[model samples]
Target chain A: MMSLRSFRDPVLVALSLVALWQVLHHIAGDSAITAPAPTLTHLWEMIGQARFLPHLRETGLAFLQALAIACGGGILIGVVLGGHRLTGEVAEPILVGLYSVPKITLYPVILLLFGLGMPAKVAFGALHGIIPVVLFTMNAVRNVNRTYLRTGRTMRLAPMQTAWFILIPATLPEIFTGLRIGFSLTLLGTMLGELFASQRGLGFLLMTAIELNDVKTILAIAVLISAFAVLCNAALLAVDTRLHRGAAPETSGK
Target chain B: MKKATWIRTVFLVGALGALEVACRSGAIPATMVTAPSAMVTTLVKTMQSDEIGGHIEQTLSAVAIAMALSITGGFAIGFILNWFPVLRRAFAPFLAAYYAIPHFAFYPLLIVIFGLGSTPLIVLATLFAMVAMIVATMTGLDRVPRVLLKTARIHRLSLLDEIWRVRLPAAAPHLLSGLKLAVAYSFIGVIAGEFILSTSGIGHEIAFAYDNFDNPRMYALILFVLAIVTAFNMTVYAYERRLMRRRGI
Candidate 1:
């Protein structure tokens, strides 16, 4: 009964969201917001179109490249900073400040540096994502139980061996959580990059639709992006939960 | 006062000095970035002309309105949700995943519904910001000590009085954090909306300047926005620290 209730609640919420969309459609009229059903249909049609695929591919490639840089650079920097106490202290506030700033303001500066193409988009996306990853990973590394490090030392483990066997497992859960957030923000940054001064991508499509006042297309594209973001986030969230849960017992025993 | 703060300040100043040198020496092209001092000079010049006063006023007012709406509305919704466990459960996943959505996608739809001008910008900022407050409110309320409520009951305090005196004080830290997030998100939302497609605002001015290759003006405006936000956030951070110190946390 408890499980049933849990399952039912989300379904109910989903239904209500659709109902709200329908009601909004009624109020705003066809020109403003397309109904949910038609928007979904439009999304399907968009997915089937050949021209849409290139934009998707463009966005996908940019996102992947950005994610790589963010994750790799963030982890490397985080590890170095975390391992050094003073460096972490000096960098922490700056990173937090950067995290809060509306990075969209810096988009033009990025464009100026990287030029108006894939490089700008990737750089923007990475800029959005890398901070949180570094912050989280730094904290994760700093919080790793001292005993584990001592144990590795007592066993005469090499630095690489200790990192691989002790550090990675301990910090993996928190680091993964950072990755999940970074993933979302990177997508947002990429889309924003495409929205302005760009010729191709999902964001460009949305921008064009806005300019044309093509309500159906705008709704369709939004729905598509939202669906993708939500699904990927959900998947990441599941893994995050599992990793944290798995880590709980080990941490508690210490 | 602290060692870290002194070091950070020196580091920042040094970095700025290096950039200034780079810009002045033509190692870094003026087309890419103006010197920090040049940006400040341009900002002062622009301010003296009063050309950007209206734009600044429009953007700040919209952000203020959005921040107010987000805080009040989010607290109300969160308070109500806290009362109903089932509703809160339903909302949990959605709230968790909320930031993942590219909310700017809805800007056009908002422009359609609310029409152009600051109305849509305020609405977008409000929507963008409200969720953070809601989450914070719920967490704050959830952490209010059970013993305080029991004491309120023992005193036979009125519901409003109990909330105001005991619950609110207990939850103040989380609420303050929520306020900080709401402020930041509001700025982001309004500025980003204006940057994307608005007629007037600091954001629009930056975009316009960028388009026209008015590098100094663009850098000045960006610098002004960043300076304002950083100062505001630092003030909040200082307040939070004072609060924590008073509580011996």
Candidate 2:
């Protein structure tokens, strides 16, 4: 059974958030924002609409493709750089610099190259999500216990076997953390991509709502996206914590 | 210079040279991307024309205000939260989930509430940037050595003095990193908001140029933004390294 103490904080946070929303709604008036209750009702209505499915499908497809590229490309780059010390050192600063740059500025360039479509959206999403995964995986690989490598060598394992059997398992926990962070960033990037110069998707809907001064639709969409993001992040965070905890004792024992 | 730095410099230069070659040779169409040299010349010419000065000033000032607000306000809020375990516990999940929420989604809502001007942008940017500082402050405070607190207590220092003398110095590194992130996020929030919808700013100009098929001007503006941000970050990073070195960390 879940403990009361553990449940209490989230409830309190949720109530306070609702309270803040209500206050803001009152202050901003009906034209600027709908009350929380009305917004929730509007969101339900939105979910049931025939047109909503296509936009949902578009966003979901783009997000999944972006996630695939981000995870795969990030892990591959991470493995390559991490396995080679000099390369990792050379690339580290460059990666960090790229991470901080407001990549939104590059959207025009991306559009010019990829054109206005799924490719552009997926590319933008992957670009945001890839860096943290690389950074985390690189560190995890670098920190792999020397004894494990020695054991692999002693067993006369091939390089590929060593990587698969030894390296991946050892770094999985930290790498999972990277993936969790990457998941959120990729979603953010994809949504940002759709926000500008897109004809369909939730972001496009949001833009349309903004132009039409449709406060209810805007809030409903924002709430919907934020809910999805938070719920997914919470799940990933739970798995991430468990993995890290599971790894701790093994390292200490070693 | 160090070997890695040397190699990195060469690598960067080579990449730029390759891009220049491609652009000049029609391998990459001018419609797609302007040459690196052409981007530089256009940027220089744009600066000389001074037409974009107002846009630059608008973006930079908004970023500056957002950074200032987030840094100071975040530190204060973080300090209070750290002092209250109950509050911290309640807020922890929200804090953890904060960045995932696609904050730009609220830009239109903010515009509606605050009306069309820099207010909404500043508020949005501040909200976006402040959490980094708050998280950093909490972490920095949490990691301050127990022995330092003991020393402070033994000296009979007041709470304010204890925090100022012992806590702040000990937490300076994390705070500095937080400062770096705040600056970056502020720029991101402001530029992205302006890019999405704004009457005047560098981001708006870039979007305007993009729509008009002014590839040269668009690339030049992009180049300018990237250069300034990179330079600013490098300065902060250098300062952080110097501080770390002095502290023998």
Candidate 3:
């Protein structure tokens, strides 16, 4: 008998997918969309290769640099806008309108400005991630309980002290969510840059595989990117959960 | 209309004026920064020739089909999950993590299957939009008050009646937000696919301009796309606001 706790539906789903892959492989008879077994084996081979680390490092470094900019700059802008009543009211709708525009369209402009290099990739990633961070930060800062501000004032806290002690703590939970989403978007933007016109990175590798019609390599790269994204997201989510533990539970809405 | 609006207008104008000055003065290189004046003329000329119009129509149609497919598909999936606790439990972890995985990575796989053109574009957009909708629909449905559900049962309402009357209306706001996201995601996904694979569409045109280093045309096209997206967002936001007011939310 199967143990109840150990019985994950995903395991069954994964097995079924593998079975489906085998069936498709037999039916299609050596075309594109290679079977899972070969793809898995190829993935291992690719991972063992020397070129993998450089591409991974390039992607990783660009993402980190961009994420850093987005978080710091986004939070600062968010705080200012959220702290000021008139400024927030005046700017919020315009920001929202701008946010609706796909960041990918600006990729061309970025390439033109920064050229085919790490700077372009970083800018693109930062641009993609920054908007969500600012929006979330603005909302979080705006929603900080008034009583806390009152208490800070009662204690005669300085403006910086009030922001540091009262505002940041209260807003941490929502801002964490923003950072998580922002990081995901940054990764996406960097990959898009790499795919579109970069000489290096996982995206470039994927593009190369596509050009060659190398299905196994393409699948392997995709798996690598997906795994990276999932791991980063999971790590951030764990941090977010931990941060929320002692704080009053906040309602997280879209 | 308001003092704040006036201030915002002034602020925007001031920024634009500064940028214009910088561009004209060669503080920023001409190749890197197209003047707003240049962008306006380029946009008007492009519109007059109907060069941008065709691309807009293509994108709009793709988005419409994608939105329809995703919403319908998402609702079906969401309802099924709601009806089956075991399925929801089994799939929750996977579904939760799905958003982080850049769906574009699957484009290669899609290309292998569909070959190219509009089919992969629509499918990818549909997939992207559908995930957001599914999550939204599930959350919205999950939030339907237990009290109202109990009341429906107390009133001897049938399952269909309870779902149609009580559940859907209660979930409308959440669903609308999901719809908003689906629309945006669909637009983004379709454009991305077109950028990566298509022979035609605004995304393809933008890439063409970029390849040729046509700054004016590139800026104009980006602006045109931005305007369309903003219009869609504003309309959805207005509709959602009206619904919220109706529901006294």
Candidate achieving the largest DockQ? 2
Estimate the Cα RMSD of every predicted model relative to the unseen true structure.
2.3, 2.2, 3.5
Q: What order do you get sorting by lDDT, best first?
A: 2, 1, 3
Q: DockQ of candidates 1 onward, in order?
A: 0.67, 0.71, 0.52
Q: Sorted on TM-score, highest at the top, how do the candidates line up?
A: 2, 1, 3
10 residues in a row with least lDDT, candidate 3 chain A: A245-254
Score every model by TM-score: 0.94, 0.94, 0.88
lDDT of 2 by residue, A1-254 (tens): 34577569877898989999999988988988789999999999999999999999999999999999999999999988998999998999999999989899999999999999899999999999999999998998888999999999999999999989998889999999899889988998999999999999998999888888788998899999988987887788778878888799877676
- Restricted to chain B, the TM-score per model reads 0.94, 0.95, 0.88
Residue A163 alpha-carbon offset, candidate 3, angstroms: 6.4
**CAPRI docking class of candidate 3:** medium
Single-chain TM-score of chain A, each candidate: 0.94, 0.93, 0.86
Measured with C-alpha atoms, the lDDT of residue B231 in candidate 3 is 82
Candidate 3, residues A1-254: lDDT per residue as tens digits?
33453256756765786798778667655556678778889999987889788988898899899999999999999999998988898888777766667778888888888888899999999988898899999999998888788989999999999878988889998899888888877887888878888899888888888878787788777777777776676578668867877465544422
Residue range A160-207, candidate 1, lDDT tens digits:
999899999999999998888888888888888999889888889999
For model 2, what is the error of residue A106's alpha carbon versus the real structure, in angstroms, after optimal superposition? 0.6
lDDT string, candidate 2, B27-116, tens digits? 999999999999999999999997799999999999999999999999998888898988887786677678778787677778878888
lDDT of 3 by residue, B101-164 (tens): 6677677667667766677888999998898888889999999988999999999999899989
